[model samples]
Target chain A: MKTLTPIEQLPLFTTQIKAFINWTRKNALWPLPFGTACCGIEYMAVVGSHYDISRLGAEVVRFSPRQADLLIVAGTITEKMAPVLRQIYEQMPEPKWVISMGVCASSGGFYRAYHTVQGIQSIVPVDAYVPGCPPTPEAVFQAVIKLQEKISKGDTPSQRLVAKKKMAELTSGNLENTGS
Target chain B: MEYHFQLVHQIKESLGDKAITSVETGIGNPFECVLVVRREDVRKIAEYLKGQRNFQYLMDICGVHYPNREQTLEAVYHFYNRDQKQRVRLKVPHKEGESVPSLTPVYKAANWFEREAFDMMGLKFEGHPDLTRILCHHQFVGHALRKDYPATQNQVCDAPEVFSFPPLPLNEDEDVLTNQRTLVNIGPSHPATHGTFRIYAELQGERIMRAKAEIGYLHRCFEKMAETHKYQQVIPYTDRLNYLSAPMNNAGYCRAVEKLIGIEIPARAQYIRVILNELSRIIDHLVCIGTTSVDMGALTTFWFCFRQRENVYELFEALCGNRMLTTITRVGGVYGDIDDEWKRRCTGVIKTLRETIDEVDRLLTNNKIWLNRMKGTGYVSQANAIDYGFTGPCLRAAGVDHDLRKAEPYYDYDRLEFDVPVFTDSDNFARYMVRMEEMRQSCRLVEQAIAKIPDGPIQVNDPKIVLPPKAEVYTNIEALMNHFMLVINGIQPPKGEIYSYTEAANGELGFYIVSDGTGYPYRVKVRPPCFPIYSSFEETITGGQIADAVATLGQFNVVAGELDR
Candidate 1:
């Protein structure tokens, strides 16, 4: 996959309009920082003057879930907080993505206690996982760029889920016809 | 000294002979008096302590579980006298199902502490107003802190709490005759709330008639997790408590462990610890003031303060590889030593932040909207502040010229020269001023500490506690065995309990550690300073504008990681 990326072959099945939409989206990704713990502080650091997230076109951090296209789960998510996170995700409009920031949000890190959720993937489908106890802002920026690449490719989690479902349906239909 | 002995005598005389069990003094713990009171006399003893002996500050109320004891549950009440610098712990041993008298009637601060005791330890407090689960979800089945409950048995509760206000009271001076108050639920995920904290505000027009905050959304169970891990492993967990000042928590926890083990870290380590702690405090105050200004619609202070904070974090990153949760301090000393380049970075950041603070002061100090909004709102008197367990800047803002650094003089605080700024207003603006002044003082402390620091080993030289040097481990056979033993066995001290506190950026962050002659802790309860302050927040803002409550909250710096745990 790393070798194939250098060649950068364009897919024949996509349209110019789709390409333009992805291009615009890849540039201007509004992130909602669902920051709750130590990673929240690092997320703020990413927005600080030193990191200057404005250069990446993801500077507009929307607090409301409705306004954001990307959800940055940038901290630990407890069991009590999982439902609220789900509700917020469901509140967002379509064509949304999630960056599970830090070790806590990705795999609960070292906090394997009663209240903490092991990983946010149990509830929310994640597009990227930034690995660090509290990932540096540079790491977060890298994750954002990686997410943009996926967005431009039209390879989203929801889109892939739908595609997988269609393939399963097609296979099941073939089996039924052959059996009959 | 007289009060400690008199406390037991007076309680026994007032509540009859059966009310008093026994009195123990300084059993390897810092508290002056550890009174074993009968279960029924909890409230009465609290009343006597507050009214007679001036133990106005109900420091904390925590419950401990001893599975093998005759009474499996014991509720511990910590009371502090500000003037005398004395602390008393009341131990009430009771059965699991038995309900002890609540301390809420005596100290208003006991409201959340008692609820948390019930939530975690399953010790019921009789007549605790609204004694449901506080930290855990409302539907949480078992007490998570109990020995029987599995540490990793996570429970899910999806239902949001149904917040209800009291029925509209009939008022003689009412302009309108009907019930017109509206309930506004502010947080849990909102940007104004720094973390996962919810405020249920009952508003009449723009005024908040009553407010109740729901916490525990970020309850990662630090205590339960601490008990499961080795003693040294808990330092990283401490970092999350007040993430704004991670090193302060590290220093506090290390100090507690050092006290328990009866080992003094080298003077050089102490100086370095002080420097790092003051640095963390500076950033903490900057973030608090900056964020508070941001909440008031000034965005420039956030940028200015965060810029300085990032610079400090860079210095921390240079010292230790990590930025935010830099578990830099170890059991005896610190992770690594700083060189001249690092010292230069520290002084440079300190100098730049002083100018940035001046800029913020110019923007905020005399602004009309700032004064009008913050001056007359969220007032807490000096006496009332103590009653509500307000510590650190919030306590100082109420005209209590008390600073733990000055009073207790931990580490090199005695050698440092700084003033504790006090304000008599006890309002939101006072809190802002206190924090600003504190940042200036913290800057001074860091500079002075850097000047006084002598060249020596960063880590303690003790072979039993700390690991052997890398070169020694690689070459010498004895050093290899020492390193192996230290790594595998961890730090094991004699069985004892100690409550060691340090002046954290927010307030007094106390660590109540119980070691059972092993590497792993028996029980660890963090006296999170923000917990009591956040508890009194609702009462402080009653009958004030909702805006004032929001401003007050930012000033309080209620870190949910510290508050919930």
Candidate 2:
């Protein structure tokens, strides 16, 4: 077989680029089912039928860190699972957004014990926090929509401000409580 | 019944000087006979019961450690007369170093119970076939359940001594010797083995020859944790046990506390409890049946069942505001009443569930491939099932008509109209059918509960047990103070011990709480259905094919949290 020139590809157009971007965004939102514990059960519920996350075109929950884009940290991330969680985050492709889907994932909720990681943001960057000891499936859907909003706005993924914000809240106790 | 009591008395007379005090009744019915027989008499007594007295079903075997007593380890055996419907308690006290003879040769259920006693309290069972540590790892040194055993700093250093099964002739190649028994550890990853669990399987080719379940990965010392936390504070921890069936765990805990407090729950509360309990049961059996299908390569059925479960979880979320771990029930009653919106949502979900269940049945029930994969794979003989003390759908699948919902009706289960589904096969297919039928019955129970739900205060009228409404807490100072006290320092029941059980999705989820007239429970012991069922996995799947083990394990529906706890 003779070698072919690399420049024989079709010319890129604005419509094609937009379509490609839209299609890639829709098709490849490989959700990292970063389920740490119990709330992970509800996280499954979100992707499951009642909420039907597939409607947003992001139902393929990847267990591996390398193949994922959206990380749904749906349970209590203890100290033990934290390092592994960070490793998984580091393995994910760039422009990854983390959805902390429960109170346990958000701020350690009921289990703010010494062993618990307090919040998942302590390890990975979080874009949204669905608050509850275990957030309801509806709340999980809303969080997913919120993440999609940020993506559609062309906004960069939020850094670890939530962790700092939580630390500050704990230290100062001056922040107004959000509608959890 | 009198003759049965006389027979038990005759047996006690046979023991003569060995038999200690036999307390009759206060604990209800069957006539409680406490035997202070020597540890060596355990097997003899077990044999005698089976041979002479006909105490066929070994209902439960519990190990109690009295650190201050003359004899430290007390193994209590509760046997039920299958034909007579009578229960008897047989107690044998042993010292720390002594080894009791195993009754596993007689009633195979004693196999796991004996191993558990050995693993937890370090009480040895002489002549127990393959009695290495069952729950804790091989390296686990100290028995955690012993009164003197330190809760913290317990470690298993070395691998347990391998149980020598009947050895097959060498396969010529030396490499076969090295690779014959492949050990695979699954879970503690949150999803693998239903709740936090680790299974160490000894596989002879993909087939699990003798797999030992290493539980307590997510122990959290919940028993000790409950001991420190107040009665109300412990509800949240119960939610973690069987995350799939939190309501059952909650009900078990609350029922135990209610018994100790000696207060009757309101009729409305009972109805609410029945509804929620049945709802949880529906969700649980859905997960069990669905996950078993998933384990056996039936993804579509799993999806269908999961769809139904999604609606169920939404109902739970609507009622409790939490999906996975709904710490909805309070000490005396529920945290709050289901509002009009919640009731409407529940009704809507229930309707959907009925249709979804039918959809799931259509997808799974008659599917030839599904049936082929499960049919004769993990068959438990009727004799073995009863011998193993298998409860829930596992025993029901083996043709046992015993269901705690009917046998020992709790939370107005008697009032609820539903049929217990049973099958004779006792295989994975039978278990699948049982759970599917159970979900349908649960739906019927929920419908009945919803229709007859009385208009009254949801919580019990007794102010000591349940907290006032949150709205009242915000307005009234007394209510606010009551809320503060209830939240911080939970309710304290009088000094007493009570055993309470509920028909959890998997089986009978029971809790025995001992209160020392303190805010916290004196001791909390969970009689989770999964622990015994999971422990019997090795025996169940021993001769079956490799896929059968996974299907069997899935069919068992062993929640690791409940198992380890």
Q: By DockQ, who's the top model here? A: 1
After superposing candidate 2, which stretches have Cα over 4 Å from the reference?
A: A1-37, A54-58, A63-132, A137-180, B1-8, B22-37, B65-73, B91-99, B122-124, B129-212, B339-345, B469-489
Among all windows of ten consecutive residues in candidate 1 chain A, which has the lowest summed lDDT?
A: A171-180
Candidate closest to the true structure, highest TM-score: 1
Q: Candidate 2, B359: how far from true, in Å?
A: 1.4
Q: Which CAPRI level is candidate 1?
A: medium
lDDT of 1 at B112: 92
CA lDDT of each prediction against the hidden true structure: 0.88, 0.72
Q: Write the per-residue lDDT of candidate 2 for residues B383-422, one digit (tens) a residue.
A: 8777777789998999999898898776688888999998
**lDDT per residue, candidate 1, B1-565, as tens digits?**
5766677777778899888778777544444687788898888888888998888998888889999998999998888887888888888999868999888888889899989998999989888888989999988998999999999898887867788976876786876735478889987998889789999999888898888889999999999999998888899999999998999999999999988898889889999899989889988888888778888998888988899988888898898998888999999899889888888888998899899888889988999988987897888878779888989999999999889999888888999999999998999899899988988998899999999898888878888888887998999999999988877888997787777888998888888888899889999999999999999888888888888888888888899889886
In model 1, the runs with Cα more than 4 Å from the true position are: A1-15, A159-180, B1-3, B16-18, B27-31, B169-179
Q: In model 2, what lDDT does residue A111 have?
A: 53
Residue pairs in collision within model 1 = none
